[model samples]
Target: MPTDIAFLAIAEAQQLYHWLPAALELARRPDVRVSILSPSDQILALVESYDPTGSLRRVRLRRPPSRPDSLFRQPSRLATLLLNYPTIARFPTLVTTEISSAWLRRVPGFRSRLILIKHGAGDREGGYKKRHRDFDLTLVAGEKDRRRMIDRGLCTAETVAVGGYPKFDLKADRQRFFPDDKPVLLYNPHFDPALSSWINHGPAMLAALESLTDWNVIIAPHTKLAIKAPPIVSSAPHIRVDMGSRHSIDMSYTMSADVYLGDVSSQVYEFLIQPRPCIFLNLDHRDASGDAFAHWKLGQVIERADALPQALARANDLQPGFVAAQEAAMQQSIDLSPVPASQRQADLILNFAKKGV
Candidate 1:
């Protein structure tokens, strides 16, 4: 018998690099039935970008016809919990990411056989899993994350390392998007306050990078960072801002950049897989106390925006040590073996679903 499995996301985060590829790989299977939930048109647009035919059945939260700006007022939003409560309550197995963990805990009699996929680079600041070890399996990118999850007690010692983001499955090839004439700089800022752009002067940090010459810059900040205001793309002819839309699963820009600049965003780890130079901006100059990705020891930290020009110069002058360190960390956090990562993760999800049947 085929088990009825539903994959839920709080919003359309599946379009970006971390979650979407895994979801896409899983959705390709005939046995697995996947669904998504999005309360807004923006999210719906992202969903359509993936499954445009409306072939992918998505669950809509029951809500009053009035479009409530607040999630609390949306009847459709309310319907999600009311609807999922029963499905989750009776389903033999449930898999979700941390974004929906709080809701899952509230579901009546529905907290067994759960899987929590570690989404970001773990850290004490990102509220690294202090509670709710109810998950039977925790999908981690690599050993470093596994150690932090275990050390922080985010999950039990039984958690398994499934390798890095299924998105990296595309990195095995060497297709160039642009002519290899100029070096490309990918600015991947983190969304967390303690680990990223929210606390530091975000707009200023970006403006400073605008002055650089010769290199092409791609401003690919964290997805959540755009909720406040869409990122404004500005720069000399060499720069391009990816702020027009959020890329929840697309990371080809990050993979192709020659250098990376940002705080604790996990894309740094992903960019590091190619072993390019990465620079950390200590925008506020505050110590990133207990940030797990910061501890990865891959790049340099610039304390002042004025130092950026020199930092870029140094970044270009030096051999790619940061890239090599990122590769090492990638192996430790995800499997560096020759096998395809997306297929590996898809197989694991399918096998888990099969057992429930």
Candidate 2:
């Protein structure tokens, strides 16, 4: 009998990058038949570009209709899974990077094992929710997440595995987005209106950066932010505004930037892979003593827009103070394993399929 496995790429095209590396790794197994389900044509094109030979099976699910009352009113992830139940049910295991995949357990006669591979390694409160415990097995980035989930009674230690982030294996090309060699500042804000700095201080923050000639600023907000509204742009030679472009998710800005500025975005952990200067915007003025705000300890936190200019000016001087803390946080957030993360995840999936939890 053949062993079947499926990888679900049900969200934005950018999210595909998070699972592509691991999917390819699993496809290489002789006994494993890998299938990819995506609703976005752009995501399909990306997968084709990555694997021209069509080594892995690709299924194009229908995109959700824009109108609320349309037949596919629900989001594409849940809708696609329901529509393709017959084909999806054939597989013994289904893998996804989205938390919403937990809903798969609700489908009647759906006995497939759900494995969740989280997209980021941030310390946000959303990562510790009860929904995460619904999956049969969740692959996390490091010990911090595993410990947090177990301590909160979300899941048992055996149910959660400590595999490094798979996206790290997918390398980004060194494309110069800036004109000059000036230090690059990547301003990556989260999409949440409550925790994000974009809602209240984004415009003023961009205007302030335009006045500074010392840094080349790149305003690359979270991809979901562009889906709702237009991003703030500037004509200034030193600043560039990008709203959910291919470059935004390709890790280009994270790798090229000298400094990081954001609020509640997991990409900050990606940038901290090298322990660079970081500045976090606290729009709600929340106390930093809690565990949810642990990431704030990695950088200088500025609560007001007026103080941003001075913070940016003195970033270099303040960076040294946070270096030790950033390094410690980086270790706790990600597990830099000797083996590739994709290979490790593929092995875990195969092992889990053979021995049910």
**Best model per lDDT:** 2
Candidate 1 achieves a global lDDT of: 0.61
Error of 2 at 133 (Å): 2.5
Over 4 Å off in model 1, which ranges? 12-19, 23-57, 61-79, 87-90, 122-124, 170-181, 195-199, 228-235, 244-249, 293-296
How much does each candidate deviate from the true structure in C-alpha RMSD? 4.3, 2.9
Worst 10 residues of 2 by lDDT: 66-75
Per-residue accuracy of model 1 over 70-183 as CA lDDT, tens digit each: 321223434555555654455455555654444566566664466666665534356464544656677777777777767767676655556566667643333354454678
Candidate 2 local lDDT, 153-243, one digit each (tens) = 8779888888888777885755688778988889998877777888667677777778778888999998888755565778999998888
Quote the positional error of residue 335 for candidate 2 in Å.
Answer: 0.5
Question: All candidates' lDDT scores?
Answer: 0.61, 0.80
lDDT of 2: 0.80
